[model samples]
Target: MGKIFTVLLVIVGFVYAKPEIVIEDPWVRAVPPTAKNTALFMVIKNVGDDPDTLIGVKTDISKMVSIHKTVNQNGVMKMVHVDKLTIPPNSKVELKPGGFHIMIMGLKRGLKIGENVKFTLIFEKSGRIILEAPVKMK
Candidate 1:
């Protein structure tokens, strides 16, 4: 009887787990003191059963923020601004350097190492995610 009760408790806990999208490895690269642009990288995972779109990004430390993707066309590497990035259900999307990343332009000030930068990621279905990315020099 005790074993059955323990199993029931475990099942109940799993059923009541939080259901939402997850953000993984959210960090920012500390830019040079004279640099004017920097990027943030992260992996977004949709743990829920529904798809979600990252519609907008807002930050106080930059003059402009946008989703950007780098592509090689005709042997020329170009960076283009993307409007929205979608995260499929039960899948993960990685935003890393040299690929899809969050571009921050016109930095108000240079990012110092170990500083926390706050960002608000607006999603279409999962709502706004408030997160802070630690600045690293990697």
Candidate 2:
């Protein structure tokens, strides 16, 4: 009876434990009211044993959502589309200014400071993760 009870307790605990996901330093830079584009930055840390792929992003404020990476072509900054961003097992992937970012293009409305932009980020392994990026004056 004792062994059966212990086994049952262990199984229950394992079943209820979900993967640990950590999002760090999430922020959106406020753009000029007349500008058509802006960006978001954050670091996603996956503490699970398996890898995850960030496949898609959704936000209502932008007419289009895309994953972009910056590159220097002859000292000129250029943005390119990414097929997918990977978060390795027990690792963190950073989306920082002048690096990888979420490009919000064709802005439907102006983003003001102290406001939040909700984003749904879809992952291949761990499913979907939602992020709330606060707009701040840069």
For model 2, how does the per-residue alpha-carbon lDDT over 1-138 read when each residue is reduced to its tens digit?
Answer: 999999999888667644456789899989889999999889988887566788989899999989999988999999999979988778898998889999989999999998999998888866788889999886
Give the C-alpha miss distance for residue 76 in model 1, angstroms.
1.7
TM-score of each: 0.84, 0.83
Please tell me which predicted candidate would have the highest lDDT against the true structure.
1
Task: Please state every model's RMSD to the true fold in angstroms.
Answer: 6.7, 4.9
CA error at residue 110 for candidate 1, angstroms = 1.2
> Each candidate: what lDDT?
0.90, 0.87
TM-score of model 2 vs. true structure: 0.83
Specify the poorest-scoring 10-residue window by lDDT in model 2: 13-22
lDDT of 1 by residue, 1-138 (tens): 999999999888666643368998899989889999999999999997667899999999999999999888998999998999988878899998889999999999988899899999999877899999999988
